[model samples]
Target: MDVDPLLTQARQLWIELAGAPVAFPTRGVAVVASAESSTCPPGWVGIVALGDAAICTVPTDDLVGVVTRACHMLPVAALTDPERLAAVLPVTQVLGPATLAYCDDHSYRPQRRQPIEQLPVHHPDLVDFLASVPAEDAAECGLTDITSAAYVLRAGTAIVAAAGYRHWPRRVAHLSVLTAPSRRGRGLARAVAGAATADSLADGLVPQWRARPAASRRVARALGFRELGAQLSVRVGGSDQTRLGPGSNTTAP
Candidate 1:
């Protein structure tokens, strides 16, 4: 199957984030050890798949053995070398099969946006709003100075929904959006997400939305994101023991 050009670009951006050598094949799984600090979630590995190939980024080559085992859980049809993945690592610890989605300039379409307020992280109202939401939600939107930009929709003094992006390699924007529990099903999520995405595109960055919620995926589609592929993460213990399951408890992006 032919890989989407945008998906290919997204994979390359991830490889760059890993600080892997440019000579690394963009289409296969490899064990790369980089001293660089990862921008990805803590203890979570990243896998970018397109057509029949995948690029898996682990924090260190020491984890490569376990990463290969986790890759076995991926759908065979999606991997370029399932046999190799199975052969390399022991089937001991596997953590997840998370879905990752991406959107580029061509793939995104602006939706009818709501009246959103772009705010600095230090804005009093934004700060108060973050406090009102779950801590995980606040952190995901970069409450700690990680996002380059943020936008929120409010009902008077109360923030109903918010979205933002963090700087990722190759000018890619890692997008995150959240809607208050009581305010969901009102299109507020899409409204704020659309606003943030528009800003990212305006700044010449490709917005990437990675999450597992079907509702989140719907919001992404409404804003013109395409499902690129799924990622699998495995936890490697100190002694090479592996554990396999879903991702840890965290708010959806």
Candidate 2:
């Protein structure tokens, strides 16, 4: 499979952050390595692979031990190195795998030529409007100066959809989006996402759309985003925490 240049660059950044040698895995495998301090969540090591990467901040490097009991659940080929494979596995048994999607200027298409409102992060109305959404969504959309830009779609006085990006390493934009539940299925998510992605491209930032839903993937595909690959996430506890799909919290290119 042809790797997107942007994806390659993202992988390089992750490898550098991991402070480990690059080990791009084959089509259906994952690789794990020690991560630099604070590069990943506390207590876990960062794992990166072309197919299913993960950051396990679990404070221990004994992944081999964890996978030993579940050896039968994984593919034999994927167990070439139990320790490395464990790093990419779900931190817990309950949480399913996650995915990371991304797009560059070459892949993104700003097709939704609808009117989008660029709202000030500190605007009173925007602040009040964001309060109605999830805290993570508001923070991801630039609750402060950390965001590069944010855009929204309004119907009358109500904000129906919003999109934005936070600055990530290597000039990448971690894009996020949200659409009101009552206003979903109307393509509002795609419109706002396109607006924000276009702004990211204009500012020379690669938009990284990390999501886990088929619907969100469709919105991304509508805007010409491609699936870089899937990722895995397992919380320390049994809580099944995964990044929301497009239109809910995080969005695509």
Candidate 3:
């Protein structure tokens, strides 16, 4: 697919995921208070900005004016910048500042590493595979909770690598991939993820890769995914505040 159209489609998928209908401003940022946003934790704020434009989602209508004012005061880039966003929004808690990347059929680069298996997301061997990885990695990848068919690689009977997607509205396949610590340096991540990405594309769903780790992002890029936007989830309410850094959670939906 042409990069422009692919990117536009990707942007539309995020707009639909924002829950309440809203569009990015031509300049600065657009803030919308909508309780329907699934991308944010219940009662949290969500920001999805493609390139220079942005749309912010808050829980209540009362906060829209404040958030709009605060967000508009800064550059649209601040929504993806944790420190800048936290300074302005009433960020009581935060989830990620993940890079939102998208891949389509034309741009996809399939890997030759093979013998991959397509399994249902809830296969029993998957639990053992998840147990083998670090808790933080498991939390970040979220492979066990994916709703799409899994593309996995195995070592004997042990599943060493896995990739899949959660079926989001608007034909978005949010991708998740994880490799065992022992299996990290191998090309298994690329193989399984490439398989999953190909499968998602074949099913006519846009594959969305939200990655926090550089390695994970590298895998997506290697598969020809373009970084089109950034997603951040913030809980806004009382005076209690926390910032995103080493200690904060980076897990996102």
* TM-score attained by model 1: 0.76
**Residue 169 lDDT (model 2):** 72
lDDT of 2 by residue, 1-253 (tens): 6766876776655555554444444333333434232233433433333444332223345653553344334553343233445564554432223345678778888774888888876777666777887776555444343375568788898887877777777787777777776787899989988887888888888787766567677877887877665444333334333333221224522
lDDT at position 181, candidate 2: 64
Evaluate residue 186 in candidate 2 and report its C-alpha lDDT on the 0 to 100 scale.
Answer: 92
Comparing 1 and 3 by TM-score, which wins?
A: 3
Ranking the candidates on TM-score from highest down gives 3, 1, 2
Residue 243 local lDDT, model 2: 36
* Superposition error at 142 for model 1 (Å): 3.7
lDDT of 1: 0.63
Best candidate according to TM-score: 3
Backbone clashes, each candidate: 7, 8, 0
lDDT of 1 at 124: 80
For each candidate, give its TM-score against the true structure.
0.76, 0.72, 0.88
Which residue segments of model 2 deviate by more than 4 Å?
Answer: 1-3, 17-22, 25-40, 45-48, 51-58, 64-96, 134-146, 235-253
lDDT of 3 by residue, 149-222 (tens): 88889999999989888887778888888888877877788899899889899999998888777888888899
Residue pairs with backbone atoms closer than 3 Å in model 2 (clashes): 43-57, 43-58, 43-59, 44-56, 44-57, 44-58, 45-56, 91-234
> Model 2 lDDT vs. the true structure?
0.58
RMSD of 3: 4.1
What stretches of model 1 exceed 4 Å from their correct place?
1-3, 22-28, 35-46, 58-96, 141-143, 239-253
Candidate 1 local lDDT, residue 236: 37
